[model samples]
Target: MKQKIAVLGPGSWGTALAQVLVENGHETILWGKNPAQVKEINEQHTNHHYLPDLILPTELKATISLEEAIKDADALLFVIPTKAIREVAHQVAAIVENQPYIIHASKGLEQISHKRISEVLAEEIPEDKRKEIIVLSGPSHAEEVAVHDITTITAASPELDAATYVQELFMNEYFRIYTNDDVIGVELGAALKNIIALGAGAMVGLGFGDNAKAAIMTRGLAEISRLGVALGANPLTFIGLSGVGDLIVTCTSVHSRNWRTGQLLGQGKKLEEILNNMGMIVEGVSTTKAALELSKQLGVEMPITEAIHSVLYEGKDIKIAAKDIMLRDGRIENEFS
Candidate 1:
């Protein structure tokens, strides 16, 4: 079952996924806007800027032209940042002729509309040109996946066939795929956990112990589930790989850009300075704004999200934000009550 797959965006995640596809014996083309990076991947079999010190598979191809990547491809996998999704999808929609399975691994809600990535994709890509959209998400990191470290993730779609197809498409000895029907839950869990990761990193930056981290993570899950359920997601899905699993990895791992960004903020660095230096997308920063807006509209009380939003956007001191969360009116542990 060798298929032609186009992986859009040549960042660490996209390159790692493209390598997996090539190893799986598929024709994988990685597309990037930067000609220099595309040339480096095509000629050197390495993406040094994103996955430094890791050489990509020799079979993995890179391209600068979107039309070249999409032409005759059986599937398109998008791994770009949230902000770029609609623009990229629009371009893809204009070029793609044959029906292909549309898949996305990027995590975050649309900042203004609070739309899920799949929702945004569906809006842009006509149904005639693609099958049901599948979302690949879980606790895996690009750096670890690049080195063949054992990783498991979920491919979720309302159409079971699409999910199962993606499951078989990416599964290998080191990378495992599970299928779930709860796309809403899966996407939300993937996006919202980055917010908690920021809080986790901030806790470390503030010199707090494990107790603080544990408290935030525990309560963070509560609010995440609360908001997710309010938005029509299955409550049980929150305990699965995309929910609790993603939360654990992103919040605790040093490889998480959101966590690192929060750590810098905790260390008293300004957001603009940290973002300018990081050279990667800190999705949690934008997700925080979207989550805050959702919580307000839905009347969901998400203290951790609100606190992080204050610190990141409102210029509130991290310590004071932490104090504010701690001093909120005590309620029962169950947020659904």
Candidate 2:
């Protein structure tokens, strides 16, 4: 059955998902803060800055007003940045009269509190105004998904029905959704992979061959799962799409802002300079800080995350950090076994 869905955060990811919703014959309203961009989406059906080469669906409407976007929506999909999730949820709580199914596609951790996106939403939004939160994540990129490239992702929720409901809402010939209950593993996998991607990009920047990059990705997965399992996530989820799959794509793809940031850093560029030029958020940079802090608190060793954190925030030389990561004491490969 068709329903009204409000997609918040009119960035590339949000806009791409809105295009899919429009194709699915749903009443999709995309909300953003920029009046000019909203006007362009409503009028020209194009978001030149984010998805420059793709034309948006004419049937998909957009607005700058938050109340107008969610007043009558059946579901609310959030694709905003991690830092903005709490603030936006608070704004939604203030005006929303009806309870809408909440779904999020953002991939990062809260910096100071070290909370996941769902935790942030649950804390900010009153229970009466929202249903169980669902997180959608995997290897899918907005640029590829916008042009009908085949993509598979996991829709995870503690409630089985909620995950299934989200699966049905997003599934299509080009887009496949699988339901998983390992919300913790899925969310951590998505956020933590960005840290590895940054390291992978640094490897490339240092002119390392494929072997070095593969080692970074492999070891990166080990530590990510270590910290994740310590926090009560399913160990097996690390091998799934959200884990190894996301790590590979984000690390290798030119589309990943995190990898690109690392690449520039490896080339001896400054963080401030790279961020100013990218025009998009590098999630791994922020996630590295959060992951490093969380790892220390949890007593889990995350060498790559620590290295990236040092390179990004602690003024450590990128090459020296990479060398330090390699020269660290070796351990049994199959610690999980």
Candidate 3:
């Protein structure tokens, strides 16, 4: 059955997911803040700034008005950044009177509150107007997904029906969707892995060999699992797609914005300069701060996240931070227990 779905924020991920919906035969409306970009998506069917050289589906429609985008929509997919999730949810709450399944693809924690994207949505979207909030995450990248690369992702919700519903909505041969009920683990895995990816990219930028990257990824997962478990997430979830799977892809792939940002930082570029040059949100930078805060608050030690935070925010030298991680007192890995 075809459905009307509103995909909010016409960024790379949003545009890519909207394209997936179009292929799924849904009446997809992509919403963006920039009227010029909206017009380009509608008229040219190309988002060159985000997905260059990829032609979007001609049937994939876009609009700048919130009211027009959400009108009669069966589901809403929020693909905006963490900083803007609250504002967008608030806006959606005002315009939406009917309950619609709310889904988010953005992977980052709120900087100030350290809340996950779903938590931010729940706080802003009223229960009456919003149905169950679902999170779609995994090793998938928007660029590859836009070009029909085979990708697998997890759709998680506490409500089994909601997860299964989303599974049906997005499942296809090119894009596979798995359903999970562990929303906490799923969201944490998605957000926390970016910290490790930054470290991985920094390793590459600093000319560290594959051995160093492997060690960082392994230890990074340990720390991420530690902090996630402390926050009531299932430890096993970290080993799943949203956890280790996502960590591997983001940390190793050239397509990851967070890893690329870390690469620039490894090359001694400033954060502001990297952001300006990349012209995209490097989610790991903000996520590092939130993970640092969460680590301190939860009493969970995250050495890699701490090192990345220091390098990105505290003006610490990358080599020195790397050395600090190496010289730390050796302890038995506890994530296994």
TM-score of each: 0.99, 0.99, 0.98
C-alpha local distance difference test of each model: 0.93, 0.92, 0.92
Candidate 3 regions exceeding 4 Å error are: 335-337
lDDT of 1 by residue, 1-337 (tens): 9999999999989988888899899999999999999999989888998999888888888888999999999999999999999999999999899999999999999979999999999999999988889999999989999899999999999999999999989999999999999999999999999999999999999999899989988899998999999999998999999999999999998999988988888999899999999998989999999999999999998889999998988889999999888898878765352
lDDT of 3 by residue, 294-323 (tens): 889988888899999999889999989999
Model 2 scores a TM of: 0.99
lDDT of 2 at 298: 89
RMSD of 3: 1.1
Query: What local lDDT score does residue 158 receive in model 2, on the 0 to 100 scale?
Result: 93
For candidate 2, lDDT tens digit of each residue in 1-337? 8989999999999999999989999999999999999999999999999999999888999999999999989999999999999999999999999999999999999999999999999998989998889999999889999999999999999999999999999899999999999999999999999999988988999999899998999989999899999999998999999999899889999899998888889999999999999998888889999999999998998888888898889999998998898788878888741
- Lowest summed lDDT across 10 adjacent residues in model 1 is found at 328-337
Model 2 has an lDDT value of: 0.92
lDDT of 1 at 25: 94
